[model samples]
Target chain A: MPSAASSQLLDADFPTRLREVAGMVETRLDALLPKPNGHQSVIFEAARYAALGGGKRLRPFLVVETARMLGGSLDEALSVGCALECLHVYSLVHDDLPCMDDDDLRRGKPTVHRAYGDAIAVLAGDALLTRSFGILGEVDLPADVKVKLVTELAMSGGMSGMIGGQVVDITVAEGERDEALITELQAMKTGALIDYAVRAGGYVAGASETELAALSAYARDMGLAFQIQDDILDVTGDAETVGKAVGKDADLGKATFVSILGLEGAQHRAKELGERAKNRLAPWDKAAQTLRDTVDFVLERKH
Target chain B: MPSAASSQLLDADFPTRLREVAGMVETRLDALLPKPNGHQSVIFEAARYAALGGGKRLRPFLVVETARMLGGSLDEALSVGCALECLHVYSLVHDDLPCMDDDDLRRGKPTVHRAYGDAIAVLAGDALLTRSFGILGEVDLPADVKVKLVTELAMSGGMSGMIGGQVVDITVAEGERDEALITELQAMKTGALIDYAVRAGGYVAGASETELAALSAYARDMGLAFQIQDDILDVTGDAETVGKAVGKDADLGKATFVSILGLEGAQHRAKELGERAKNRLAPWDKAAQTLRDTVDFVLERKH
Candidate 1:
């Protein structure tokens, strides 16, 4: 394994650190997405339009920071991080399709389907998802590491994970208020990728078993906390700030954390999850401060 | 690399051997597809419906046959073949969506979207595509081999391959009839995966550069021949035998090989391509008989 230089640290605010990583990730993503060419140029164009030019880059941040904390190569972390971002953006593009969530706006711009039409949106999403795996395959990592990352990433986003959650979400019967089902849906749909992002960082670092376990725990709690905050934001935040339709969950009568737990109860649960998430990284002490700060950011963010 | 026991061959007819391979692929696919479970059971069910008990298993047959001829492990070949099938099926499922091909029938049965609703169908397609990579990741091959397979498969099916072809097919501007453009589209959409299927078997066998080159040449010609035959069948074959809508290309006025070359010209081209494809395999002599026979099968197939 290539040794990662422990970069010098500054006591910068958490948002500043996040923005810095986001900027780096964006540059990498721009470089990574395929250039448009020939007859099939439109799909590449659509894929780039969807993947680039938007989003929090939260997953990429988690991947990079976790690898940094675990003393993993920054370059490898960025590749994996960019891959995760591609997968995330593809999901968003598909989710915004007419047959799915049918949303017009994504990241405050017309959704892929709206901008490129449904067929192109679907094809672009397909392209992005395939490119995600391709990115991992091409990353300068050990063969074994690459295999594990590909396997785990596919599992996280496939039938039993994100896709499965999406099926459940779309098929939820009206007036069914099962928090357990809703939680499972959220965990599978959203939490799985988030968890994988952190674990992927650990994998790249070749961290010890104990370190991996801690990261896994940190990711699980943090993922739930992130979702809860999203639900909270949907209720409280405006559409312009949120970048998409808000309160649509309520409008469609879909069950959410806020609906089942109540707004304050959901907020309390998220806080508890955030605290637990931070506590999981306690053993790493100062090295994990950035990750701990991330939990607070997940809870406190308005959009 | 593991040594493959060169299995004894029977002097069986070509159709019999093809059927034997297809049966084995179907059995393996049955075992590989994830079983239905819990809230996300629908996607799994739908994926199974689309993947199992249908199609010619042409790609899988190519993988297995090429590997067998090259003296590669049957088990590894089967796994790779199954993975290719999953990827192929996913593309078919997505292509049959209302906003795409809008075909209600596939393999003489209701399409995934027709049976499971559009949302479930979309999720099912996503799951299958992800599972295709996951299969490659978990295959008992050298990790480098797995990574290469993953990368190449993604490239064959992603923005520059099948998905790109589909976009061109859908977005074909009216009154535009460019044979070169159509050929490019067909090569990307259909030929890419077919080429990859044969090459994957060669990859598994650790074939020499010369052998790989020969396989590449054979696959390229065979792929075009197969596509040309498909166009001919679309015009002349009955829907019941074809197991899907026929005459649709003509109905849509799509620029197919038959449209551009005329039926006799298309037939002549396919025959010429098939002969060239067969000649590419001549160096292997008796060892490549089954694959050479596949060229004849491609040209003569009614469906």
Candidate 2:
């Protein structure tokens, strides 16, 4: 991990903060899920396994941190964070299905289908996706906020958002590979959920339209930087450290950022985009420091 | 087709009404989804194939009729109805995957995976599932109603609901078969969505708590009747009329109502449950007449 950007900000223990957010998110996820004691205990167990104990929790971190930055309650923000993470995990579970990405590992462990069966994994994913909507029905929050969050999640998480991108990805993998298509795919498949995460945080906090717009721009740029770097890492990184098979994208003949732009070009683009993302938050003061560094971290992440 | 219950009610135009609702649902679904124009158009095409053209739209029919009975606008009820139907289609698409039910046919046609391949089918299911939540963020309804609908959907459709039942169904298939287990499985898988359909209709229509309770009870009984009869049909119905593979449960060694209770016992139970379902609606007047027949129709349906 590049320590420079995160270490320099707000006397930041950047790793510590990520770990803290992940801890809180895991606890919330644990509470949010049903215990694995029902007649269909295996499904619940599989769902819990898919969601509960791993990953960086970066999306939830965005929701929690962004909400807190805009004067939202940690408790409520955490709820929304948990919901988004549930959805994120759901997508991962499905993506790893035998018919999809067909990965045997996720977040350094055997994927849900690998541990359980494909049938349970599919149901587990379905369960997680459903929870994303249900968890937002917080009576304490203004009803409009709840509706807005659900809409944001659905629009980004659904057809025109994540799934659409996934469709494009599958098609591209099967046929021709191009940078423009890859960009669109990354935007839809990955960026959409990231957009939802940040916007939801700001939405619940009642951020001004201007603030929301800025956040969107910042998130879009940061998302691009993250994906390009991810592609680059896939080409150059190690499987053990990356927690998945690396060089797999190239092996699959899928066009990626590193394919369209050479490794050096992609690295340059990521840094520039990270800078642009941080610059969008120039209006914010000290509270925005972590977000700025998050962009930087995205630019520099190895996995 | 058994025309007994449908022939007796609403000028004996019950079949016509059902057809009308199905048409309306198809039109609405067509409008809701994107045209297949993108580079990844095949997935969109497959999604449309799954959702746009067919099915009895039984779930939406319940939603529309129940809402109309409770004084909700047909148009708005249709919105919720479309969302529910979309989710139902999503479940069907995923369930038919090779790793799950592995059926090659559905709704008298090739399954989505058969027509569009597995990757597209997976993405199509995800798109539909996401849209179900996204569409509910309509500006027209009260925010509380939207939240309630999303929550209701999530609860019924999620782990504790439909997906949970599916998990149990898959697990039971791998193990021993039993009536008690089958009943529990049916409740979670099929009954939860059925419950959500009726309860959501009442919820959006501003039904009182007691009214919602009655609707829940009625839907529960109707759902059980529907599932029991479905199991019976699997034993006795023809594959051509039933659309997909029948005798699948028996071939898979899965416990079902027919397997547990025998054909006659299951049929008798379904009739009794249908009667009980109708009795719950006694508190309503003429408006609920269609719903009562719906219960009868559930008992009498051949496929």
Candidate 3:
């Protein structure tokens, strides 16, 4: 396995290619969600607002890289990546609604609710959520693969995964929560989507069983590490830097990894998890090298 | 075509058979959405609360009937019916949120938000919506059929249909809405799903172009009639009888068919539309006889 420092030494062309792929995905997403004409125009606009609102598009990147790693065409994974991002955006839109985290900011701008009012925001989230499946189901892929990918995406996003985590997080916020509960919540809420990103990419590429197993391991560890770092940043990062209002967890009385594990302990866990994630990718081809760098980037990013 | 009086003459065995089919569909839905063990338990429970909460199960019934109309098995259409119901339930859950209609009752019980709090309700809706596609995609149908069905469902549920109509409803409620605008909104919000119910059933049965076209015409007209009757009921029905709070549209200052067209005009329009819907299905076989009856039932029902 490449060392963390070595992983960062990616070819100069890598960032350019990644950006190009991201741009392509963005265009396709725009095409997939056309603005509705006539009476319900606002709903379509609200959906577009939530979807087009800026994010790093990291999930799509993972999808493209994982597909490439398994010797699959990026074209095959393009719509899948867009679908994943749509699901992610939908989750964020709902998460920031008045009933959930009740936040007003997202990605350095006012959230859907803040921008479009609560009713529109709720509908926007619903539209984006349903639209993801539409994109996936309409993609030109093999039937079995399409079924498998769609099933995996649903399981990851639904009660068994992301939604499940959100419920636990809400309960913890409303009452006293322990370290174990907090970790489990984080895994479901934040980690499930990331894990899905990696696995979905692999599935689209028709990765071997061994490769899939390895990728799953890598994703699980990376997802947890990413969440831990997020918790650490919530404590230490500024609102302007983090791109959302900071310290809401403390205000909400929510349990988090940093609150339970402590800053140093959380950092230690993240580093260990990142290393483990990297180790899992050791059996993959050179195309997976970018994914390894992504893990390191997850650990090192300040925001 | 079955006469209006003939349509009312429910086959002595049809209701019994429908109840049986509904039971089977319910069982399948339960099997498809099993509660995952551990931290995800709360999500599963909330999902069940919203999903299993009893309504007429009208959408699923339509799916089964339309499939049978096209010489397909109810067994084959079971999952499709279940998926449509899932989509319907998800919409209802979100629509009842405090930010939306702020409804406190649904199906003679507390709304999802009132019962499970807003966060869980939101997540529950998200989970159900995603799970619908998952169910459709994973069913043992041809890939092309799955794709078409999923596409139809998503389109009906997304910007051009349900969500769009909702946005228009909310917007027009803030001001005086014209008759044309109100009709457009109804066509999208209510008509879209109703249209999809028949279309998806035909899709699963491998419907021909002509049959699909005829069914679409039948569905479109019936859907409008259904919405018009719903508007009339909002003005005329009692809360206890309807199982939901009545006069919500006027209370929210939302324009409706009744509001824009007057009660007598709205009722006349419903009857006219119902007739048109029935006429469109005249070319179909005896199996479509039940569907024609359903269109009449939609307009004539008290609740």
Q: Which tens-of-lDDT digit does each residue in A61-167 have in candidate 1?
A: 99999999989999999999999999999899889888887899876788999999998998898899999999999999999999999999999999888888888
**Order by TM-score, highest first:** 1, 2, 3
**Candidate 3 chain B: 10-residue stretch with minimal lDDT:** B6-15
Tens digits of per-residue lDDT, candidate 1, B135-243, equal 9998899998899899999999988888888888777784675778878878898999988998899888888879988998999898989889998999999998876
* Docking quality tier of model 3: medium
TM-score of 3: 0.91
Give the per-residue lDDT digits (tens) of candidate 2, residues B1-303.
Answer: 223454244346678889999999989889887888776677778889999878888899998999899988889889899999989999999999998879898866899999988878877888898889887886368998888889888888887888888877666554565766777777888998888888888976889999999999988898989988888889899988776579998997766787778889998899888877877887886568788878767767777
List of chain A TM-scores, every candidate: 0.92, 0.93, 0.91
Task: Write candidate 3's Cα lDDT for B1-303 as tens digits.
Answer: 657666656466666766787788778888878764675677788788888847678788888889988877677688899999998999999999988889898877888889888988988898899889888878888877887888788899988888888887778655667787777877888888888988888988888989989888888898888888998999999988876679998997777788888999999999888888888888884667778768766876788
| Candidate scoring better on DockQ of 2 and 3 | 2
**Which residue runs does candidate 3 get wrong by more than 4 Å?**
A1-5, A8-18, A173-179, A234-264, B1-10, B173-176, B234-268
A269, model 3: CA deviation in Å? 2.8
Clashing pairs for model 3 are: none
**Residue A234, model 2, lDDT:** 97
Give me the runs in candidate 1 sitting further than 4 Å from their true place: A1-12, A236-253, B1-12, B238-252
Q: Write the per-residue lDDT of candidate 2 for residues A30-147, one digit (tens) a residue.
A: 9988898877788778889999877889999998889888988878889899999989999999999988889898866899999998888888888888888889875258998888
- Candidate 2 vs candidate 3: the lDDT winner is 2
Assess candidate 3 and give its lDDT. Answer: 0.82
